[model samples]
Target: MSDLGALFYYLGIEVRQGKEALTLDQSTYASKLLEQSSMAECKPCVTPMEERLKLTKASTAAKIDATLYRSIVGGLRYLVHTRPDIAFAVGYVSRFMEDPRENH
Candidate 1:
């Protein structure tokens, strides 16, 4: 072990330690996530999803391209490993796996 106070960088997680406390950040990972999701240029919202947003099956749900939806869900799931903050939002959207609506 190095004597540099446990500075660790692994799998996009950066851990820095100091005399007072430890800090965790993933700006790099966040950037990559945005890029992978094709949202790098998208505007930032106060929250990933609106609080009142309620998703439900549409009566006339348009068919979705499963491959695309699954790809998006997979990428979001990876972010959840470290970004628990977005877990709920990601999981909420993923629930559509049974029947994804094109409008979504």
Candidate 2:
């Protein structure tokens, strides 16, 4: 009845078709992003984020590294696009950006 030809590209992602199935991946961009963040040498994990870790509001009296913390969380945000596995962790950390504390 119908045959939709091969897909070339979509939404910044390239499409590759084979006989058996369709596979989705962001390998190229993911590699570049990892390298840019100096995480190339980091250990590879089966999961994108830890389930038990919880981020709480920091304390007011401690000294907070706003720039570094924000940068870390920002990177996480970008990573979330392809790796929604870490979206919760990234979003959790982002909540503290407005008033990051040093102690907590």
Candidate 3:
């Protein structure tokens, strides 16, 4: 596509124009996502997920709503558009959407 000339915004992502290059941000999208998932009060973290931690389908933890879990995971996937760092974590969680437990 030809230069769209400073993509002001698209799909909840804010684009900032600068001399060197353009920057994409998704704070607003993230906030609304958190609020929708009732996690607005959750703390920010450099590492969104634990390292070396393993999730399994045999957990005895209580089961969570499959629909809600899928919705949240889908949002997380969308967030990867700007925050690629969380792609691994999001993908990890997505593995359990079909039968997500609290521990997942």
Q: Which stretches of candidate 1 lie over 4 Å from their true place?
A: 1-7, 59-65
Q: Which segments of model 3 are wrong by more than 4 Å?
A: 1-6
Model 3, range 1-104, lDDT digits (tens) per residue?
78867578898889998999889999999998899899999999999888899999989999988898898899889999999899999999989988999984
lDDT of 1 by residue, 1-104 (tens): 65755569977778888899887778787887678667899998768789888777763667777777777887778778777888989999888877777765
- What 10-residue stretch in candidate 1 is worst by lDDT? 1-10
- Who is ahead in lDDT, 1 or 3? 3
Per-candidate clashes come to 0, 1, 0
**Model 2 residue 63 lDDT?**
56
For each candidate in turn, the TM-score is: 0.70, 0.55, 0.87
Tens digit per residue, CA lDDT, model 2, 5-45: 88866654566788997755566756766776668889988
Instruction: Candidate 2: give its CA RMSD in angstroms.
Output: 5.0
Give the TM-score ranking, best first.
3, 1, 2
Which ten residues in a row are the worst by lDDT in model 2?
54-63
Output the better candidate (2/3) by TM-score. Answer: 3
The root-mean-square deviation over C-alpha atoms between each candidate and the true structure, in angstroms, is 3.1, 5.0, 2.4
Worst 10 residues of 3 by lDDT: 1-10
Better of 2 and 3 by lDDT: 3
> In terms of lDDT, which candidate is stronger, 1 or 2?
1
